[model samples]
Target: MLVDQNDQALRIGPIHRSVAAVTLSDLSELSEQRGDSFEVLTDRERALSCWTDPDDDMAAFAVSDGQAWAVLRTKRTHEVDATVLHESLLPAWHVADQQVGYHHSLDQALNATSRQPGLVVAVRPPTLAQVMDAAARGLRMPRKSTSFSPKPRMGVVMRDLRDA
Candidate 1:
């Protein structure tokens, strides 16, 4: 899979169906587990309950008691250019300096700039602080500034979106 110009191509073999596809229920459970894990670490947090019904390819639902949010969706995966994402992270830091309200994704801020293709996943608001901190400390980041948590298992997750 090709995420950007700097990202090296990731080669993956055909998926093995023996491992049942991830379901909505699975995601909901994972979310709950994650929430609970977080709660245990902080009393201010709580785990939300969630469930799901089969949709498209999978069945799922999620509920966050603390956030009062629910997400239900089919099981699907796709590849996005990770390269443009790398190059875009810095400019995003400069943009984050504006918004007063709490922001979620860096891509959201950049969205107001332009709609050119090749953008990757959104960058979290905290990334702005990180970018500034790095500069203040006289350091440079390589790419994909900060991945929150639970990044997919390296080889376990692969993309086949590259065009040869």
Candidate 2:
């Protein structure tokens, strides 16, 4: 949760609230199905963020290469179990531990591992609301599940740190 140092309480900026389900499938297979224009995310649904439910029409999603794509959902239950969440994502985040691949975007990773047997791919970015709800429900998502957009790149206004 990268936040403004000045903001003692998080109340502004692009706050994430949901995450996308992980899709482990073959790159060539997905590419043949959805093509390059495949998007990994979609709007909220059923009051649930990150498209937690698997819908026929995938508004957003992530993919991995293998023969078939096995869709995986949030490893953490409504009950927050930090230990379990970390273990599930350890393979992707740490390559030294296992022969896992990580990519900036799901598509890129899917493309790279097209020939591989199977792997974990695709993770929807969680929204702030979803994150809070998960916490309330005692569930904890994997780290880096959601990425907030940076402040305006254009320097329209300038303020000194002392003044801010």
Candidate 3:
């Protein structure tokens, strides 16, 4: 499911899934080490463009410190990017698991940074096939890595057992 800037819900399948993160860590060094793998940007709007632009799906993830931004890309698919993010990049930054907050949408992430002050890392989510492949290989992704959307409505999906 996708929610527009208006907060209107749009029912859709897993065409493209991206998760955003809010943190206080500086990712420039990591981005620099990655070299051509990362495309540095100037601000959030540009980073948003990098994510939404269909002409370029190369970006695995994008990071911003509210001023400077960098988008990470790979010749491989998003699944690999997700793996590298969880397994390597994040850990190198010394970003504690608790210090990170995951947002299902870019807007939510940017909003979070606006409310507080921190860096925002927007990640491309893995496809269902990629997830299944990982599972078959006995690999595990980090928690909150994927969010199945159009979640069941609270009251509609549950019942009061007492009423039974």
Candidate whose TM-score is highest: 3
**Whole-model lDDT per candidate:** 0.29, 0.40, 0.58
- Tens-place lDDT per residue, model 1, 16-78, is 000012222443465354342111212111211222122233323222222123343323221
Off by over 4 Å in 3: 1-25, 34-36, 43-45, 49-59, 74-80, 156-164
Instruction: Sort by TM-score, best first.
Output: 3, 2, 1
What TM-score would every model get versus the actual structure? 0.21, 0.38, 0.63
Better of 1 and 3 by lDDT: 3
* Candidate 2 structure quality by residue, lDDT tens digits, 1-164: 34574764343221121122323333334444433233333322322344344433333333333334333333342232222234533333332334544455544554555545445444544445766887798865655454445444575666677876
Candidate 3 lDDT over 88-135, as tens digits, reads 666666667666777766666666677667766766566667676888
Please give the range of 10 consecutive residues that has the lowest summed lDDT in model 1: 11-20
Worst 10 residues of 2 by lDDT: 12-21
Model 2 reaches what TM-score against the true structure? Answer: 0.38
Error of 3 at 15 (Å): 14
Maximum-lDDT candidate: 3
